[model samples]
Target: MGVVVSLEDSKNRQASVKPLVDLTKGDMERVNQLILSKAGSDVQMIPEVANHLISSGGKRLRPMLTLASAAMFGYAGDSHIKLATSVEFMHTATLLHDDVVDESDLRRGKSTARTIWGNQASVLVGDFLLGQAFRMMVDVGSLDALDVLSTAASVIAEGEVLQLSVAKNMETTEDDYLQVIRAKTAALFAAAAEVGPIIAGASRAERNALKSYGMNLGLAFQLVDDVLDYGGSAAELGKNVGDDFREGKITLPVILSYRRGTPDERQFWRTAIEGGENGDENLEKALALITRYNGLGDTIARAQHYGTIARDALAPMPASALKSALLEVIDFCIERLN
Candidate 1:
């Protein structure tokens, strides 16, 4: 699906998430069960809407982070499972809400729940999932974990608002873009990773390290996602290739393309993104300008910068199967740009 051969980094032959998946398999099963159990409700429509998204194909990386983080510290209690389930619920809830806010028609190559159930039903179901998530968190009985996760919820909301403010605004800077992703995407990752050690009662330094790793990994992941919107296909991205452009979202590629173009090119961007001329012709033009300005390449470079930091974050930990798997996950995040 990556027709752009130039972007594919086949050199990272070792990049794979299989290790992490294998390492966390047993606990992940328990987490998945808990997720299904918690997502159910007496209200038939609740499960119907919740399962619509929950059953959709996804890597469930955030919940896996929770499991691996705790397991890394030798946490044996079942609380980690509940925490992982809670993390997944939080992530799913966010996706449901995001689809509504973005007015998206597709997710994971399927119609968004919002499209079928309607925005009001989708939103209410999202709130239900969030409520269930907090319920599971409370059951876990870790104040530190709760603190981290609750903070992340608020931060994610703030990020959404910040994104709304910047959408179609061509002046959005790289720093502004970073701030938005750190909140919306990376906050959950940071909290998910941090809670694992918190629940395990690990050293503060260890928790801090995992938190750092998760945040940087998320940043790299999102940067690559922004690149993929222009370079990837629906089969690969699990969504329409030009969804971001059609929505007038000012992602990293668009920001770079607009800021680094000729005056006429900049005007084209303003018309397409800000002035609501987001037709197929405009999307084609936007893609050309993005490729011409090396927007995808430079964004990937930025992703690599964060990937290095994420790798460094794990240096202090002793080598193990899990540690190696975690590193591979980092590589997978950046390599997805291909």
Candidate 2:
């Protein structure tokens, strides 16, 4: 169901993200400055909580996407900087809210903002970030760009609600899960990329191309993140491995394992996920079941499927370092499994 790259391809993938990072370096610096400025407020705790996660070493990939997508059309303006910062703020706001909703303790290998500031502070600060993001979008003065980003915000909230409805429910279908991720994860990515072309006044074909690339890339990124929850080290994930299992989150691995498992295996899952029997022993058993059913492998394969689509989405664009780097980002996302 997915294209498997050669070992040679995989080995080369390690450096894939570097070029994009290099390409966006200057713009990203401006975006970071804007982030820090906007994240601040007279309320000491607002900046305190926002900076806790912002200063935590995230890749800032979403903002970088905005920069790169703009650069692809040779855009030379300050609006991309504002838009990129807005994208980052939106992303950060979502993370703060997600940690609270998931009741998580750690993010990026540090205590979550919610853990330090309490859920109310975390939620309120998240709202503040969102308000700042929309203000920046308005400052950009582009109705189309504003429309795309605002719609993504609405879709992301819907996705969160959908995920909550399915949480710990083993009966969640693959289609249902895909819909959730598309809205929650991919919507922002699509908006980030689409706005670039909108600001640049690129053709409809180019706009659609970047949107497709971002959407598929986001899907691949999140799918790989799900796989890492079960297989990666806490150091690699920046949080404890098996947190999904502990939280009774019905990720793709659990859905696959549950549907394919034996009767006894199914009961084990029900007890562990539905009954909330998520002790250390149960987590190990869940891992065993996921591996036994090749859930992780299948999930990686699904990621590869989306990764290919993301790469192909860039094929029609003219050759440039930015385009090449974007293609390599797809490979990097998939190769993270290794």
Which runs in model 2 stand beyond 4 Å of their true positions? 1-13
Query: Which ten contiguous residues of candidate 1 have the minimum total lDDT?
Result: 1-10
What is the per-residue lDDT of model 2 for residues 121-141, given as tens digits with 9 covering 90 to 100? 999999999999999999999
For candidate 1, lDDT tens digit of each residue in 1-338?
22262445657474778889999999999988888898888999899998888889898999999999999998989999988888899899899999999999999888999999999999999999999899989998889999999999999999999999999999999999999999999999889889999988999999999999999999999988888888887876889888888898999988998899999999999999999999887788888888889898999999999999999999999999888999989988888642
Q: What TM-score fits each model?
A: 0.97, 0.96
lDDT against the true structure, each candidate: 0.89, 0.90
Largest lDDT belongs to which candidate? 2
